[model samples]
Target: MLEFDIWELYRMMLRSRLFENAVMKLWEEGKITGEMHLGTGEEAIVAGVVSQLIDGDAIAVTHRGTPQFIMRGIDPVLLLLEFFGHPKGLCKGQGGHMHLFSKEHLIAASGIVGSSGPAATGFALALSYKKQNNIAVAFFGEGAINQGMMLESMNLASVWNLPVLFVCCDNNWAVTTTTNKSIGGTLIDRAKGFGIEGCSVNGTDVEAVWELANEALSKIRNNGGPQFIHATCTHLEGHLLGDLLLRHNRDPVLMAETADSLKQYAGESLNEVLMLLRKIGGQTKKKGDPIVFIKKKLKDDADRLKLIEEEVTKQIDQVVNNALEISKGGMKND
Candidate 1:
């Protein structure tokens, strides 16, 4: 059995959450621009898998990759600076949040759907050439599984017996559309079609995901070929920071305003919008928060947990302030 420190896992999740929360605040304050896609609900999954990664193990993440990058040990200051559009960011502020790349950490992210598959597959191929026993991880949403490139990557990994773990953070929504509405069948079944064996778990349960990921990584390290993990989670902030469908559902005034506009122009799509809102509302109600779930388990050690939270919050606050300070003067290109 794989033993893990639940407190540490909780800390990782908490740190990622707090960092993103700070980013969200920056975006809300107009300090950051563009649509911000956060990995708020997939914290457990990212922390669980990343905790087991060793040096040389590469990771390719989907659009909501802040948590993954942070867990993989990327500097939060540079990441924040990147979001702040600083020249000394991970990609010199060119990649933004979605297109972050940390070559030193072997981590890459993209906003395009299904891109992680190819990216990770390429990483796995490189590792295979080195025969380093290192592995590559592809973190993406369930919706990406339907893409042809993703399926091809799975097939190639299985065929080559590459050390890659395809982690599907299934939040049941592809943008505003639910999984069932868009996806044809189960995500596991799709992986199976590529001859990749896998399992599913609750993403909100940090310990559960950690245990499962540990087993999967062990198998890959043992030359058991590629594996897949389908973890169901919730996107607490919807697809984007200020997502209209989710906002409309939560705010009556916004709903009224959206409904009126839709009724005036796109009356036929109004019911469809409301139906999606209902689904989103239902998803939020049913899903559990990863942070809350783990915190409940550690409530007996409230003092320690409180200390960790405070420390992490302080660290993130310092990172933000430092990044902001640097952005004021700007860092020259190397």
Candidate 2:
């Protein structure tokens, strides 16, 4: 049985959605620098896997990993400061969005592709040498599965029997290009080729991912070895904030088709997601979102859902306003 706090998971997932929406808004108002890459539709996968991690367990996440950071216990306000390049950020604003590290949580997010694979392997190897039971996790995208560094890391981890878990967030596309156009084999099969155990889970279903992750992590914690997870997910938006080149330079029909494809890639219910996307895009369409799905699945009452929403929204508003205030004042993140 998986030990998880369903209520807490849903609350954090709601926070993730709200925070991402705020970041996008800041970008549009020219309040933020650099391109914004969001994992708007992949909340379930990140929350599911991260919420189950223990205190000593560590993970190396990708650039689109704010949700993972939050679930792993990073302060959203500090993350906002980091994105604002403030001296008060987790890395004193030097890391920006691509590099976020909270040693307290034993979690780090990198800007480099496929870097997490080797990073987590190294961590696990150190744990093995120390005779510690702590496990390491590498959170990468399906696109990086083909990277030589990733393969080499997998081979070394398996050979050394390091306690590590490789999580492949299969969002189907590497930026603007589809993964199907690139990846040659199923990710689990590749893990098998490296003599590693692996499985695929429904990314849209948080319970499913949590169940599989619990099993895999427990096995690694007790037996000491590497594992892999090919979690199907949805990225929901463009490659980058100024992705107009890909969407506009191409046929409008192609762009619409791509958006429609993501509709099928994520949750079964788009009524809520489309509604939130419209709101984020400044449209006044009355629609629901993924949090509703979680509430319904968990049998949470309307009162409980309202409480969660109000609490998360309150926190989000505070962080967004504080970030903007800090930016306006030219204050450092400190």
Backbone clashes per model, in order? Answer: 0, 5
Return the clash pairs for model 1, or none. Answer: none
lDDT of 1 by residue, 243-281 (tens): 877777788898787777777666656677777878777
- Which candidate leads in TM-score? 1
Backbone clash pairs for candidate 2 read 87-333, 88-333, 88-334, 272-288, 272-289
TM-score of 2: 0.84
lDDT string for model 2 (1-334, tens) is 1378777778878889899889888888876789778767678888887887776888898888888887777888888888888877778989988888988888888878999999999888877788777889999998788789999999999999889999998866676456767988778899999999999987777778788988998889887589999887665555566565333334456656656876765665555444333333421111223454576786747788788889889989998887667767776433
The TM-scores of all predictions, comma-separated, are 0.95, 0.84
lDDT agreement with native, every candidate = 0.89, 0.78
Question: Who wins the lDDT comparison?
Answer: 1
CA lDDT of 326 in candidate 2? 70
